[model samples]
Target: MLPPVKKDRVITQLPQCFSPNAALHTKDGFHPQVKAMCQFQRTATVSFNIAKVIVVGDVAVGKTCLISRFCRGAFDKNYKATIGVDFEMEHFEVLGVPFSLQLWDTAGQERFKCIASTYYRGAQAIIVVFDLSSVNSLAHARQWLEDAMKENDPSSVLLFLVGTKKDLSSPDQLSQIEQEAIRLSEEIKAEYWAVSAKSGDGVREFFFRVASLTFEANVLSELERSGSRHVGDIIRITDNTDGHRRRKRTPQCC
Candidate 1:
């Protein structure tokens, strides 16, 4: 007899926070609404639940390293500038529903800014990465965010301020930058996180957190859209002689 098909493995637990104040949500698990929706659609598969996430920041701020560390589980010390953009697809199953994230690694160079800006539209999340040890990079975070916001709706996109290379920052430096980062995060309404790609500290947790949050948002959005449509019901539109249109709702006939 043929063996049964194997299912793909995915994360189950909702990743907890590194800092509650700078987190997307302080709760330790998935929201109740998301859980309830999962149960309601348990037998059906949610295809195309992909959240487009764009990573932007000053050049050489370890954007590539951060993404690579989490997605590929490898950290390369060498720095080669990203030309225009790069892409990675990471999948997850949140509350028994399939979800995925399209991680867009954008170039941070001045020359490539124009090239990268074109891909900023329709992003569900924006991750602004900076080197923790470099105060200059942190200072430019706002401008990068501003550039990214040009193509996306501020109210709809999730913002994340990430401080990379945490291992290289001294205690005093780290504390100083962290205070500023938290302030900036609050100002921009972005979540703050510190990670070391080399050590893999906070990398997995951060991405997991991103995946979970994005998945929840996607599901909630679907619920909102589908909420308007009722099963076995339809809308009827009638036109008046005065050029006005009227609508009526009626149940589908058997």
Candidate 2:
């Protein structure tokens, strides 16, 4: 049986376009609230979509700090190298759907690269981080990505180029590095974002973006696999007593 989902931090503040009261789909064809309770009881048995994210970068590039800020809402300045790998799980409600992310922080040192590389398999998303104030760290991002991608399906993985410690970089420095980062992002076909783990700037937004993208991709994949209906497919419900008919379709949530 799968382990119970521990109550951790919640990341539910979606954009204004997404309705908080949006309808959610249940497997047993019941109300969402009702299903939520039942789902909670069978937490050990319920199978839900999980997005595995791996963070990689050069040493002291703020990978752990970024994860700390997002997972625990705190940052530690005491610099310590990761031994091999660290794990964190985050639960989120996106568009009225429950989704989880398994975050893996891999060691960035050369000695731990081999050990950390073993944990990179079967990752759905890879976040390559670099220090915004250190051009050399940014220069080594390609290598970090290459190492992490070696064990996973490159085409199937979603990539994000992240610049950490944004608060420490000067405006001119940030602009120059950002341009180069953009160029590299396009070359590597990955999304790019600048964030500061220490100041908690763009950290939440970055993870929210990851959760949203991963959730959408999973939904689309399920739709394709089912092959019975396409996204936005509608169904009609009729009222026989009043001779009235309305189009209503079940919401898709996975």
Give the top-scoring candidate (TM-score).
1
Clashing pairs in 1: none
Per candidate, the number of residue pairs that clash is: 0, 0
Candidate 1 per-residue lDDT over residues 22-50, each given as its tens digit: 77778777778777666655555333356
Model 1 segments more than 4 A misplaced: 1-9, 228-254
TM-score, each model?
0.84, 0.73
Q: Estimate, for each residue in 72-152, the C-alpha lDDT of model 2 and write its tens digit.
A: 789999958787887777766544345677788888878777678878999988999999999999899998898888899
Window of ten residues with lowest summed lDDT in model 2: 17-26
| Superposition TM-score, candidate 1 onto the true structure | 0.84
lDDT of residue 244 for candidate 2: 20
Model 1 clash tally, residue pairs = 0
lDDT of each: 0.78, 0.69
